[model samples]
Target: MKSITFLTAMTVAIAATGAEAKTRLLVNCFWPSSHFACSTVLPNWVEEVERVTEGRVTGIIPPKSVAPPPEQLAAIERGIADVAVMFNGFFGDAAVGPKVAMQPFVGSHDAEAMSKALWATNREYFADEIEQVHLLSQFVISPAELYSQTDTPINSLDDLAGRKMWVLPGPLAEITKKLGTGVVSGPAVQSNEIISRGVVDGHLGLDPQAVQAFQLMPYTKSTTKFSGAIYSTSFSVFANKDKWAEISPEDQEAIMSVSGEVLGAAFGRAWNEAAAMAEAAYADAGIEVVDVDPAFETALQEASAFVTEGWLKAAEAAGIDGQGALDFYKSQIGEMTN
Candidate 1:
């Protein structure tokens, strides 16, 4: 009887020990090593998860880790990594359906408003389009501005006409075409090479850190600020479906609690600070900054209608209620901006 009791006790102890082992997740980021989205915001997410789960869940980040930014969603779906951060524009080829968020001039310049709108849109309509993975949170960067290699300046819509411009393809590309500029499509990391080799006369999708990260400052001569931001990209955190299912319910809830607006606010603060840093760097390098005149701003606004119409068409082709989503997004943006 004593031997049997000891065996039972040992089995229980071993089982308890196994249950106490930490759950580990691998997070993949496509941003460069120095980008704040990778170095600052993602680390904060890992810390928050561990803190909330009381160390039952831990994350591992492999350095210089990334798949092609557009391929990140597919990677997560395939379990290439337990978690990944991906951009909406990267999936343009997949017919992943209309991501209205990528359409130029759709949202406010403030990340908070854009992030909230994205989150709400996902909850209301985008779940099926992104159903392959478990979504954690969605966000938008500040609107992209135009950067140029000449001090010639772009004050009106007509200024962009006949210029060779590098832009990410999709609605933005279509808009550029409508404006009569030749558009070159590719990733941000390749911008320096493209510009240096004269593949493009200028670039349209300039973010402060992105320009800095790719070392494009030496090639750029001017920065143009529009009346409103021209374009912005949407991003989200995703986990492999199987991996997400394996997490304990308690830990899952803990993670979800900190994901949406909370994560967006944190990311916005980080991005805003990084933008400031980039501005300082540009100033120190003697790069010229140009703000658009009110007359040109109105012309750019008229040109934006083409991009918005393109989004509506794409959304309809994908069978999504494009008008409904757009209206809701606008409403949310107004509320958040206020």
Candidate 2:
């Protein structure tokens, strides 16, 4: 009886220590818990990390984000959060490489292809540009399209220019201003405030999924379709460097097996499916889809030239062959679609 009691106590102590030894990563989500990224993508990623690491490594989303969207990268670097995702545009001049995926009309509507191409391109030309955190995956969202809340159809540049519009930050906002459009610009999360208060007559930079997620359906009266992505947002998933280093190298390899291109493709597929569902919902909401007028398309494309030029210049400043990288990314997309 004494021997059996000692053995049971030893077994229980060992199990408790094992549980305490497991590493739990804190994954932050800036979007609401119900948002697809939080409800689907991030949770799926955490599950994969646990599975691949054979339960040695695990992750959890805190009840709230450790920081706001713009400050996510810095927060992760400071070890306030172990893992997070950030928008490339929010990084601005500090990280120019990811913007290769953001240039207007360069990407297709297919999010998976663009996401994979971005991962490949970054590996080839821009890997060194990232610092402080360990990059896990890079992905791009579906393109933003023109949507009007007012009676205007946005059939011409004149129609677009005449209305006050909410544009996504970065290139789209710059492009809209150059075209003489009255632009109210901020992060996508803040879009509801401006649009709901009757601040803008139209919105120029939301994908179908975003339109659904941001609850902009009632305000959206019509959508203007472009031949390709009018513009796309780029995203990066990363982990705190010190926290990453704490994991065993073998476990790191296991975790990475499910990250990089694999994770990017997965995120893209989710966005694609969600975007499709949202578009289907548009008809039910009485939102009209307007075909782009050829002249308007041509003129908007022409006016947006400076935005791309500025990015290319910034890329060169970062010591990359901007045009070459762009061409490679575009060619990769073409190959995938073909």
Best by lDDT: 2
Per-residue lDDT of 1-338 in model 2, one digit per residue for the tens? Answer: 99999999999999998887689999999988887889888899999999998899999998778898989998998889999999987777778988999998899999999999999999999987888789999999888989989866797888988889999888899888888999999888889999988899999888999998888998889999888788998999999998998888999999989999999998898999999999999999889998888898888888888888998999999898899899999999999988
Error of 2 at 299 (Å): 1.7
Pairs in steric clash, model 1? none
lDDT of 1 by residue, 1-338 (tens): 99999999999999897666667889997777667778888888999999998888888887876577768887788777889987766666443332667766676667667777878876776656766788788787877778777778766677787679988666667778888898887767777778888787678886787787678888788888765667887787878989888788988999988887778767766776667778899877767889878887777778778767767787887777888888887788888777
- Per-prediction count of colliding residue pairs? 0, 0
Among all windows of 10 consecutive residues in model 1, the one with the lowest summed lDDT is: 89-98
As a TM-score, model 1 comes out at 0.88
lDDT of all predictions, in order shown? 0.77, 0.90
Kindly report which residue pairs in candidate 2 clash with one another: none
For all predicted structures, in order, the TM-scores are: 0.88, 0.93
Superposing all C-alpha atoms, what RMSD in Å does each candidate have to the true structure? 2.7, 2.4
